[model samples]
Target: MLCKIPDIAKGVISLFASGRLSTEDYREIMQPQIESYRKSTGKTYIYVEADVLLEGWQHQSLAGSGQVQLPNFDALVLVGGPDWFGNAVRLMGPFMQGEVAWYPLEQKALAIQWIAARTDSCN
Candidate 1:
């Protein structure tokens, strides 16, 4: 399950991944959001909550490669369980050059606020 964070004014794209995440799910759920962000701001600042069970080598490989093709962004916020959070950071680190922030699930709201503020300052 993925959702955009509410109340942030910038073109920030957020997603929450829960349970098993397949490649098809990634494409179906995330691709549209990425496209929407691109159309809105010509870039995307993606925040991902890592509460998912990642499966299949192919899915992981595709995710790793596909991230490189993502539109430019201002930042990425990763929030979730510690292990998954670490994994998410490791997987997505290379593709990210802008500010990157991470927080535990308990701190998601704060993370969003920080990201929003940071986005505002950058623009």
Candidate 2:
């Protein structure tokens, strides 16, 4: 499942991914949000919560496609397991040129706050 974080007031767009993620899920949920963020902020900062179930070749292929579809963002906050963090870093390396920070799921608030602050300063 994927969800947008509530209570974030800045231009930074946040998402939480849990359980299994599918290509259809990305098209339905993430794509529209990314489009909206681009239209509003010109740049986006994404915060992704771990607990993601990255299973199946189709799911992985969809994730790769989604990465290509994303707009240039100022930063990315990855909150999850170390393995997930490492995979995300490798996958997103090419698309990201700005700051990328990782923290455990326990530090979700800190991650959000950091991304918000970074986005603010960048703007």
Candidate 3:
């Protein structure tokens, strides 16, 4: 399930995913934010909490679905997930156009701080 994490900050949308991730959930919950980001010229931020990496998800398809809008992101913070997932993202982070940070579940505050610093969102 994907649930919106509300009241975090202005211009920032946070989402939490549990159990197995679904493309349908992604579309219903996340795609709107991505669309809003794409339509707006203003800076915005995103935070995703998908702590576990469950089997049966095609990671590439989920990622590929957002490729067009990825470059327009102001900043994104991801909290938790497996070490390998974090490592893979970190490896590609430097090459991406926007700032991307990953934090352990315990360091969620730091992830919020990092993304807040990059956005004009009043948190």
Candidate 4:
């Protein structure tokens, strides 16, 4: 299940995923709040805690035909997850419009702080 991590700084959306994350979870649970915030606020900063995924996004059948609109982030901070996943995200950093950062699960606090600091730059 994906649960929102509360108490995060304003302008930043944080989510914690602990089990299988289905497209339904993203579209039904995650998307609405994200789109709502994006529509209200011009920029978006996202933080995700992905240390405990029973099945990750790569295992999902999400592809071309029914692609959904994703929020354009100002900063994307990912904490925890497999090493390869972290590496892939880091490698894709340059190709992404927003900044991408990865941190170990243990450094979650630092990752949140980093994202919060990034949000401060826009203000």
Of 2 and 4, the candidate ahead on TM-score is 4
Which candidate gets the maximum lDDT versus the true structure? 4
Positional deviation of residue 91's Cα in model 1 after best superposition, in angstroms: 8.2
Q: How high is each candidate's TM-score?
A: 0.68, 0.73, 0.74, 0.84
Model 1, residue 60: C-alpha shift (Å): 6.5
Residue-by-residue lDDT tens digits, candidate 1, 8-118: 446777676665555565566677888887787666677777664633224463565663244456677777744755676767777687777778778878988978887
Residue-pair clashes, model 3: 0
> Each prediction's Cα lDDT score?
0.66, 0.69, 0.71, 0.77
Give the clash count for model 4. 0
**Residues 44-91 of candidate 2: C-alpha lDDT, one tens digit per residue:** 778877674643225464555553244556787777754655576767
Alpha carbon deviation, residue 74, candidate 3 (Å): 1.1
Better of 2 and 3 by lDDT: 3
Clashing pairs in 2: none
Candidate 1 has what TM-score? 0.68
**Candidate number achieving the greatest TM-score relative to the actual structure:** 4
- Each prediction's number of clashing residue pairs: 0, 0, 0, 0
Cα lDDT tens digits for candidate 4, 1-123? 677878477888878876677677788767876787688887788888886453564344356645444557788888887676678778888989889998988998899899999889886
